[model samples]
Target chain A: MGALPELSVDIGGLKIKNPVIAASGTFGYGDELAPFYDPSLLGAIIVKGLSLRPMPGNPPPRIVETPCGLLNAIGLANIGIEAFVGEKLPSLATIKAPIITNIYGHTIEDYAEMARRIEGVKGIAAVEVNISCPNVEQGGMAFGRDPDSAARVADRVVENTTKPVIVKLTPNVTDIGLIAKAVEAAGAQSISVTNTFLGMAVDVATRRPKLANMVGGLSGPAIKPMALYLVHEVVKAVRIPVIGLGGIMDYHDALEFLLVGARAIQVGTANLVNPKAAIEIVNGLTDFCLREKIKDINEIIGALETKGEDHEKKGDRKDKSKANF
Target chain B: MDKSRYPMVEEVVSIGFNREIGKDTFLMGFPCVALTSRAKPGQFLMIQVDRQAKDPLLRRPFSIHGVLDSNRLMILYKVVGKGTALLSALREGDTISAIGPLGNGFTLPGPGERALLVAGGMGIAPLFFLTQVLTRAQNHSVKMFLGFPTSQDVVLIDQLKGLGVDLSLTTEDGSLGIKGLVTDLWDQTLSQESTQKPVTYACGPASMLKEIAQKAIARNLRCYVCLEGYMGCGLGICQGCAAKAAGSKDKPYYYVCQDGPVFSAEMIDWEVM
Candidate 1:
């Protein structure tokens, strides 16, 4: 096979070697995935959620496995932004791929503070605002749930740093389109959609909640369809690029995201099963493009739109209809 | 320190699903792991609970308990969280991913002196292998001080005793052993000792380890405390498990995944623990 054609793409100010990047939290700082696989192959690695101060995160047990999905109530445990610059960022400078940091805050100032502090870091490519965090009080869900609040945060960060800001939208909202449009209108260089849906798990024996926090954001294969729908909606709503993510495990799913108008794709829960999920998806996409006689793989981007809304709905129904449980 | 050996899972048996541990903790009972790499007293194994299972993404870590030979290693762990919980639900014949004999185990045989091993809760797991190595090393005399919450909480005691080292016990309710915390017994033994340093090794709750570190300092005896930290990557990359070492105060901190899940008493930040 003629060494899968170089699948490079640039989104916002970031230059990705390929269109595949490991979603935040799943690829903890770049080094965790370094030992198992090479980091150079990835488009970029989004580090776990970072805060202004060190957070202990939710009390244990923090994770649960649902069929084809996972529920994590880690509560954004991180070493804080200062530590990221002091310890983590310096280390990532050695890797070839661009490094994207995901920032979470309880207030607008926290988001600005993180962006200001991380400005001009040597290896950082951009900042992805994680507006969907439901566990926190001041930040997280408060900002992402509403288009206005989400845009405000995105705008503040845009002014705070020169680095391209990608606003990550929440799928728990009634209309992800409005939120996507709001962030884009606020001058966001790019928008990444569908940060885990609000979910809860129960103990069958005790009739109690499984996660100590009671409710958590759900991700993995189970949330892919929702992710795709949001990605599709957001792509149409915004003219700027969109980074699509949610339960994306394999290349085929990633191809679907590209067809739905995602300029880039983030591999989230799939990294849990395989640390090399993003690299594999890139390789798979390359292979698929080559097999389909596609000269420019970018042609596949937004390919699903050609089917029209009705055709896409029918396709989704047929796929879900065959799904066993 | 270096991953001289990559991890490979030898077996996976799901004893059952445990709701109390978590909604997902599979009580994956692995009969054996490949121990050829030689994990000392405090080393650990990074276990991928179910190779084929997809929901729980990252590999869960466990402390290595016993190494029978180059071909077989044993880990003693409770079903906690999605990784282990899912692991515990597997059938008799299943394969899981295990990478290990990682981390530097405790230094052994302190100048031909007698040693005492103290464990609290699941902390007792790693010392199982430590005892065997100590007994076999000429000139090193070993004893074990084990504690659990209740009778059913007790495990590996008979196995430890069968190794023919001196043994004592403690329980919170005094069900089957000495009453009170394991530290109580450790304090009693240390307060009275003067000439015999009795190098100590302990594992368990962070609070207990902190107390043990304090007692080790107070008693002027050498001690190694195995630590526990939340991890995203069992390897040192995540920075999720970075911990402050007691003596390294002037310096930054150490990564538990890499620097140590095991650190010398003086080396660990007992206060934070």
Candidate 2:
């Protein structure tokens, strides 16, 4: 009977209408999903990762399906930053929602240059520095695996551009909390916790790897639990907002991430499986708020309860397990 | 690549029938007037086999096999992997989510030009629809060459026979019309006919398509081939299905889901495919 629950949220200073974002790589250049649903319905649209020059990507067999997961070695294929700004940004800027440009590079200079190129772009709301793509051989996961390099990449992007910088992190690291804190200190506005995990698959009959690159980045529901734990740790470690994403398929999965102190959530592989997934989650969040009689969706963010003694002991047990590692 | 030409439809359509036409192959039909009315010959459908499970995370892509009764759309698929095996178990009256009329279909042949339809094994799926369209047009003489691994693999014979085209069949083990690859029949057709302006349209394995493309190029013929690739989203968003472009150094890849499932043979680089 009352007005619809307010779903708007802020990722650092970049304000979006909702918390459900279409992750990079899965949602192309914001035009692919236009046939399925309106692109402006979501909180933000992040195009595929771009580079200094057009990248041809890896060879055939770039993707393979695993058990409730997908392994892809696409190698950060894009039409370069110039092409995106010239060809794609014009149409994308017309959309109502914020458009975030996702950029990756083969070097620190490449990352800084990419930030400089999109500096005063009219349509772009933010820049997501991809220092965590495991598919590429250089400058991708290489920059995110260590605290020093991750902070350096984040610091350079922050210095080159006035746009809000959200450094996306990799899960294939020794201590994700340490890297999260490092980037926050280096002037990143927010952090998107966890990119695809490094994985591989083999064909038994041919005795060959399923992917041409031999190893690829694993995503989808298979990595949800691990990604959620990593998001929880990063949210606790840093004061900046955290965007949680890993195999988030539906509104229930989105709720799981938001409850764990994430300011927003990204739907990656789910976008590939179902084109209208982000919109559906947005609708689901509204319905959930209406049914629960919540005034605003922010009431649900970081609202997880850990008051019971049993929960505290379980946290202690996890801490002990981490010490064992 | 001009997506506005064919507006995509995502719907939950009920299955009209799901039956086996041959060994490990199926012919499934669903009443989807939206798809049947807008779909072209070479466009494809991304069908979600199991909506409840996440094991097969992505939808499986199948070429639009044919249309029946002007309301029902068909998909001819062979059981080769886990996805196909799951699809084979689906029965009549059950609902499956599908998005379609996706990708660019085969370009229609010009008037008075002879249409050469080639199929290898299960590659006959889309060409069957092309044959139907071509046969109904005026001044378009249609000739088909179908090749299978064995007689057991041969399918749609009774239906294809009713289409009223000059059809030839071949098998590797000599279990059918002639014992040889389908290219041999194609070669004979090309060598035997010199007067008619022939346009080639083919779908099949890479090796077969490459051979046909090479021969068609040598004769300076306008040839179009429908290709298959492992796709995450049949909507060009995934960019998973990358195919090499012919003589192109600047832009090296063409996504099979967008640039084509059907492409001019001259547009692709055969050496790297």
Candidate 3:
């Protein structure tokens, strides 16, 4: 009868109703999915990737289904940052949850321009820097792949935007912990680890690629294990909160991230499969807390039990991540 | 005006029937109230083949074929790939975890307007549902042009024949009614029939729709089309089904799953799409 459980959390100082955010690219500005359920019911919503100018995106067959996952080479298709701030921000204002806009660019300047433009925007609680889209031909994963380049992009956005900045990291890099440390040192308020892995699929009979572009970012449950390791390493390497995402399907997956030290979790590919997934995760997490007699969801954060025999294994892993840092 | 349409509804509905209507093509019926009651023509449903499968993680999107009652409807699908093949294994009385009535439906004809429905291959699903909406209207002058590769490739004839429409069927191999492409039949209709320049509504291969859009543009006729694309989410989130805007220099793309499964003929940019 009473309030079930406290599920809200703050990321880089932005308060959310819960710890489940609809990840960028999966929740298209929240306007389309708003019909199915009030997106405000979730912790927050991150709109799709936007740039300085509107992108026409890649050609047809942008997405192809892989075993337990999807490969997409959409090339960061979006209404430019100006159109989004001008046309889309107003509608999202009426919603109760914080709106985190996902911004991408072909260059560091592009990221800073978008950041500067949205600096004083009323509704957007934070700006998520997407420097890790592997599908695009240029500028997306380029910056995130190198520590120096990632630091430059993060520093530019951090300096330009008064609103908090969450750098969205890609898993395609060799050592994500390096990029996390670089961004954190550059003053990024928080980190969203990780983005999709670069992969491709083809129809062997026709001798044609499944997607129009030869390669794309792979997402879904297939990449979760790899993503969990990356998140855990990044959480261990950096002091900033890690917003975990990359095939989080349900509350159990969300719980996994929180336990691994993610301040919150973003529902990405799962939103494509189920529009209400973020809300379901929020509701399910409350149910889990109720059943377990846990009153505070914060207790679940970094709750991974690494006792006795497991200490050596996790400690060795930490040492490796430290080397990357 | 129609029953209030919902963009997304999830339910495990019992398949009242599942059978082959044509070669490698089948129809499955589901009696789910949440969908059928609010269903509109041109809307689609995403059938999750194996909820446990990850490779083909996305649901196979199927257009609503027809509304049988307040709680029953059917999905017409062709077994082309992995998802549909997984769907084909289901039998009558089996339960399907599906979500629908997604996307913007076909805009119904006005009081004074006559309807022209063009379909190609399995794209006939949404148009077939439009015929049902037209059948119940006062202005019932519905002309249909259905195109298939050959006679053996055709389906939905017996059911469509019952609609009392001015039906025209075409096959590329001359194995059926008029010979040549479906566009040939459309050209013939334009030149032959003189029914106050009927408003055109088409759902089919991109080529056929483009042909109609071009012809509609030349003749100055109102046209609407439903486009099919490889989609991740039948909902608009993935942007996987983005259609290149045709004939426009300003805006370049339209989200096919949301902005339209149905679009005005001239509004799309065909050159790049």
For model 3, residues B76-175, the per-residue Cα lDDT tens digits are 9988888788788888877777887878898888886888899998879999999988987857588898999999989988888887777889899989
Error at B250, model 2, angstroms: 2.6
Question: Candidate 3: which stretches are off by over 4 Å?
Answer: A1-3, A307-325, B1-8, B50-55, B110-114, B176-179
Worst 10 residues of 3 chain B by lDDT: B1-10
lDDT of 1 by residue, A93-176 (tens): 768888899998988889988889888776788999999987655689889988888899999899999998998888888988
Q: What is candidate 2's lDDT per residue for A33-76, written digit by digit as tens?
A: 88777778899988899999999999888999999999999998
Name the lDDT value of residue B195 in candidate 3. Answer: 55
TM-scores, in order shown? 0.78, 0.96, 0.90
lDDT of 3 at B31: 86
Question: lDDT of candidate 3?
Answer: 0.86
Best-fitting candidate, measured by TM-score? Answer: 2
lDDT for every model? 0.76, 0.91, 0.86
Model 1 chain B weakest 10-residue run by lDDT: B17-26
Per DockQ, the best of the predicted structures is 2
lDDT of 3 by residue, A1-325 (tens): 4568988788886878789998999888776677667777888889999989988888878998888888899888888888888888887776788889999889999898999999988888999999899988889899999999999999999999789999999998888899999999999989998899999898999999888888999999999999999999999999988999988988888888999999999999988887777888888898888766678899989989777657788888678635532
lDDT of candidate 3 at residue B199, scale 0 to 100:
88
